[model samples]
Target: MNFKYVSYLWDEAKAKSLGNNQVDLLIYRSNLLGADLRLTNYGGGNTSCKTTEKHPLTNEPTEVMWVKGSGGDLGTLKKSGLAALYMDRLLDLKKIYRGLQYEDEMVELFNHCIYDLNSKAPSIDTPLHAFLPFKHIDHLHPDAVIAIAASKDGKAINQELFEGKLGWVDWQRPGFDLGLKLADCLAQNPDIKGIILGQHGLFTWGDEAYSSYLNTLEVIEKASEYLASNEGKRRPVFGGVKIQALEKEQRLTQASKLAPILRGLCSSYQQMVGHFTDDERVLQFVNSNDLDKLAPLGTSCPDHFLRTKIRPLVLELAPDEDITDYKKIKEKLIPAFEEYRKGYTAYYEQCKHPNSPKIRDTNPVVILWKGVGMFTFAKDKQTARVASEFYINAINVMRGAEAISEYISLALQEAFNIEYWLLEEAKLQRMPKEKPLSRKVALITGSAGGIGKAIAKKFVQEGACVVLCDNDADRLKGAEEEFEKTYGKDSFSSNVVDVTDNQSIAKLYQTACLAFGGVDIIVNSAGISISRTIEETKESEWDLMYDILVKGQFLISQQGVEILRKQGLGGDIVNIVSKNALVSGPNNAGYGSAKAAQLHLSRLLAAELGKDKIRVNSVNPDAVIADSKIWAGAWAEGRAKAYGVTVEELPKFYASRTLLNEIILPEDIANGVFACVGGLLNKSTGNVINVDGGLAAAFVR
Candidate 1:
């Protein structure tokens, strides 16, 4: 039971809680093993159990296999996510089996074996689980185990460590043929608990769930111990660090600046969101003397290479260059990135089969910068983050393999075959279409209040990350809590920002840059309302309203344009003006005048920024009384008195006056802004969208 590298986390009480339900026990065991990154990368491993089930027709017992379904993570596998196949039906497929070249066709045959009518689709590894003669099995991509499997003398290393307690199979891409070879290996060596897949991963099994889980951990632990004693405490790895890493804060600052440039370059074909990491291991690899030699050799594990792409683009520098110099990095990165695309294009041309999927975006998924860390870009944040994670797993595998013997990677042709496999392409083709704001990020002032909060929610639902800004610290904190509760934590970042203050606005943009690389949409929604005749209105009141209503838009737009220009990605600026901007109303001098000015400013920005490919538009919302911070105070009484109605009668009064007899809510205003900035208006700028239930007097001419 001695453990060093990976922890043993099987709780007896927890396992016993599942009782006699073997399927529940299977899930419990799978989650425990998948808990550690050392055991498996996210969505990179499989687990299964074979149990007796009622035959659908006979009401008699039949053996069935429950394997983790295709495209699911082991740690989060649910009953619905498990692919259930009748074991007899799956085994019967060998009757019609052709040779290895016909293996992919086996996937089509797998559908016929489904034990449950609505079972999740089986993974290619379904055969790996089905053909093995064990009740419970775990197939994992543990870095320690893959390290040995990916070593120069991997088979001999298994013999050295397991001493023939485990079987060995040379690298064959997982499919029906590899599954058959696994069964043959187990039959030849009946005493072995599992098989080591050359340059791939490990498979271990037992008759019971916990036992199989323990056996999987046992094998990985021993491999980890062997590497630790020999390499963990020994000489420096990757030929020792060559370029020393910058101090923590400096590297992060550099990363903040570099991510947007990379994001911009990669977004030529499609928009991209980015994730950054500076893990100690990543730093060691990027700064190592052997990085240039080892990195381009590519990753060995399919799980690793598939997410990270075959290899990474490593940033180069002369010994005299300072890694912290952002100016120098900005100049060099584009050419280096271009060379990677050319290399990738040539790789595709060299290895593509007739039916191969057309070469994709060609941009590198994982980028390695010496003395910095790693940056990965993808269509969404989670994918980008996961890509970064998979590369770290690749780094670990290389480290472990190099520790005991020379590390080995997949052959380029073989890697190409797996990466561009038509089956894999079909999965990509099956993905849902991108949401309108899929890769966009927005920054909103007054986001803690009614219309602004609603707009932030709508943007997130449409797949945009948002930065929620408000000047009121308490309200912003409360709004942040609501946002986290409503949309999980990663949907947005929040900061206390005063739009009227230029210095405050500058720091807000920095927060946006640090949190999400940069912003794509800027919404000016902060406002205060007052209903006063010229005699009652103070000079200070007019200045305050303009500062918040008009100048807030101006300041936020000015700061946000800097980021948008830096990204070279055209963006959106939505000004939330008011119907009062168009309608002449009594006792509304200051509020009306400022909104009119705001509307004009939107048109002016649109005309000015069109050359920059930035679109500017305004949404005019009328009588937005419900849940409005402005309406909750004296503004409500003032407006109600102007209409000769009590504050209590205001909602009905406003509704009756609108042409459609409908009262506007915060969400309605949010929709108007969306209509202006969403792809529907991609070619239109300097436009006004009215969400006021048809206010004739407020209509834009």
Candidate 2:
């Protein structure tokens, strides 16, 4: 069959290479299936296989069910992530089942069924995967199949689309009960290869891993073809588009202005990072006539709404107004967000369980604007990006459902129940605590340089999203690639910026806004130095030093402040100053004076911006010899000449002069910067930290 929507990536040789290890083949099948979002979204769905393993205690072959554990993504799953439980013990859970009220209790009981004290917790759908008769099983939320599942006539459609080979089960919140019903459905239609769970997703199974994977592909492919065939008809989607999307540049430009405002308002309850997109499907949905009608219905898939929340808050401007008018958009977003909060609180009041987790973060995770795009805000960058993707999956479900029949949203009560489920609350409690800078976004100028790169890496390690800005495009690209491999593409973004130029600085902040909502930290580490005597300092040399060290920092800070105030989130600004700024040094007239200017500027800004809660601090380091760009050229030779020492002995000379006799390094400078903003110094600002191995003269008075 010619497959249009999904890619069949199964390699026969690769499957054979796994040999006879059942769990290994299951993992292979899982990775292949999960490589495409068409099969399942990130961290969505679960796969399982029944295997015979020698018991850790008894040393006897035992039937252990190995299923994808809670919070594990199929694409990245390993043996450690699979929960192993005794089959007989898991099935024995049925004997004591006291009905739906005790469903959550069943999850707790699953702990008692572990085969060999496996630490990975089983998902709530453990019964669904465990009780299934097949040795291998696949459960996925493929957009094509979910569209059919979320349709008004999903059950009848599922049977018709796959003929007698596929069976249907009504939507029941996934639990021990739903698991029992799924098994019953298959039992009733013994010849069917899979069952479509209404308003949920697809389930396919076979005796082996390869067969199960193929069965899943077969089901989703058929659904895609069916949806594709109908999409060719006129007015096939949401009653056709009422407004065409803006040009790509116009859309993102408007998004940049709109994103910070939305991020700020949504972050009132808690800080959030943001993501933006204008994919074709998103534009088709948001710009449609039926958007107003369809949007409030909410997403149907459990996994979709889990991250995106039940319904997205739709935002749009009047036809008469200009989308580029940032001021006007800001005015609209504030009250709309307030109203959204009120509605959300009311939703809680209406449907909340008596023991529900305290109404979590009333902020809407997903926000939609007509003719613009979708913006999602979450605690961190990856979560924000994943939430956007999930909502897009929701849009796909909506499209397929609406094209063939009326889309059926899950009942608000069910959405509420799932959102407030105790099991989910426990899961959240188990999550590791947020790192120091987790939700913060920091923009570090001269990030390709040693000290700047160290600061950027530290911030990312502490969980802040960083924007790496520098005039050197090649170095900036290399820095981003290095960060991408380690911290991932979301942890940092790179921009080629000449900090001395006002327009260049402006665009850099704009990129920060579009990339990660708004800036929470500003690091002005870009620098240059000339170690010439006052008499030898040329006019051009002095001007160049001041341009980069003084004017450059001012312009970058000016732009960053605008965004910080817009976000209404207090921010941090760390200026990389020099010990020369404090202690007078010979042959350093230009460099020393410029450093003094940057040092004083930080203090002045701290005093003036106190009301705005923007803290400004300086990290003064005398000799950051290791990995520092400032020490790589003429400055080293010139300083060495002034000290009457060889360039190679400069580090020792500086270290010997200090009371502690310790050599200063770039990472030490980075540590000082992080100390200023890493929650430890929230109440302290305008202070200068001397990272020159205890140099008395450079210490702030």
Candidate 3:
């Protein structure tokens, strides 16, 4: 509504493109609209432009409609993302179409009408945009407009609010039929500036791109102002006893325990990854007394049904229930998810048509658990985040609508039609193959920095949801933010955990379960080395060594196996041992002995857990100097002095000592870890992989 369109940005977009100027303009406008979350969130809205260009083969002028393509977010849309359709060819199909019973035929017609054979698939709403008369059209589900449109008296309120400026179309499932209805509505009201699809969204168009964009903003701003004036003073209050507010750490601790249980309950044929949020706004709704009554009303808009389904599954915890009690939490979670599944099946059966696509998995995308918090689940992290964002926005809009009047969403049949629409089904089918670790979760200790961080990055890149654990709270926070920015907020989470403590190690497993359901891969990379002779070493120093190097591995791995066994899914554990474990040096008695014991522990666990298909392996690296916290400052200076060189030359000296004469990096060690945990060495467990640029002494027979 603020209309922050800067002229220079538009100029820059135009200046870069010589051909396909229309697409360039469309991308520019789409980005502007998408930049404002109020206008659209994630992949919710679409834009299109009409243009005439010469066909590449025929050299004849052809009318083309370039519309936003599927799977591409408008905020980062590129010219290639716009599907170019031959307008004359598409409009001609309306004449030849015998009454089509199934929507699949209509989708086929649209696909055949594409002017560029290689263009990305057009959006499902392409028919609606094509049927409209204007040269440019913009459609968005703005929260403000939805607040007005979803009100109990939505149609009447829209009519009153816009006066005669906008036309109204009753809720129709988005397909050819709805597209035809939209065209009919516009034809009936020739002078209207826009069309408001009841409980759906807003559509505006003009001869120029800017006009359509501006009209959308103006209409949304007006609706926002109208709502503010009428209902701004009221605050929604639920009748529940406000539980004593817990501190942030306590809330997170509770969430960690509750998350895994709910995650396990939600898992189906395909694993479901969970992402939790105690976000202030989300908490306000989940904690509200009216949650059971209000949360079931349904999605704010129709397109949302594609991702979030009709409504969230609300799990009501007992007022006095202790969330930290894992056993009690499990008792509550199982029944709640099962009940939700049954209700979903009933809903699907009631509304499904004979030709409707197969029912989507019954697992709910959004879950509102009492006392704990809200969670969103998906096949991968990015999608989970998107679903979460939409639901949060829906909560705000529904709250606004309720303040004005009882909020109402579309009928179940309408939502079902959109959810099972063949176009969306086809879009899902057309998605590229998933990465190797697509739905798997990996937990890496010492991930706040060093080799652990590198392993975490690699796992995330390969499409695994990563849970990063480290003892350094400050570094953990920084790592969490960095990974979230690069891989998306849902892909990675960081927890401050001291591996030497059993409780802390248990918390790490809980965090992984809560953050990503349960773990399939565990990497024990947290370690320390003490440079002391056997005669000089204190008893405390030896205790510290064994606690971190031996006992820590046992505790974390033990907890990880428990969660993995619950999941009944095979898992991998990669321990970061050292070359010293295989070949000891003077003054390395404590560190070397501890690491050797850890190596044997890995072998024993592999032998014990092989029946469960849990693989345990170790990677022994000699002197990885770069990006290693263990080798920083005094340690590096001391090693350099021992090698008769400065710190800069120490790396070269160590590399020369190796058979391969190559300096080993953290990434090199991570690659070895990856081989063990990434199923590359699935059949070769209880083995030591030397990642020391081939140190002869450390070679395993």
- Model 3: lDDT to the true structure: 0.79
* Best-matching candidate per lDDT: 2
Q: Evaluate all candidate structures by whole-model CA lDDT and list the values in order.
A: 0.87, 0.88, 0.79
Q: Is candidate 2 or candidate 3 better by lDDT?
A: 2
Off by over 4 Å in 1: 1-4, 232-234, 317-331, 472-486, 531-541
Q: After superposition, how far is residue 622 of candidate 3 from its true place, in Å?
A: 2.5
Question: What TM-score does each of the candidates earn?
Answer: 0.94, 0.98, 0.86
lDDT of 3 by residue, 533-638 (tens): 6787889989998998898899899888877766556788889999989886767788899999999999999999999888989999888877777788566765
- Encode model 1's per-residue lDDT on 395-442: one tens digit a residue: 988998988888989998999999999899988898898888899988
The superposed Cα distance between candidate 3 and the true structure at residue 246, in angstroms, equals 5.7
Best by TM-score: 2
**What pairs collide in candidate 1?**
none
Cα lDDT of model 2 by residue, 320-346, tens digit: 346455566778777888888898899
lDDT of residue 605 for candidate 2: 96
Please report the TM-score between candidate 2 and the true structure. Answer: 0.98
Candidate 2 runs further than 4 Å off: 232-234, 318-328
Question: What number of backbone clashes does candidate 1 have, counting pairs of residues 3 or more apart or in separate chains?
Answer: 0
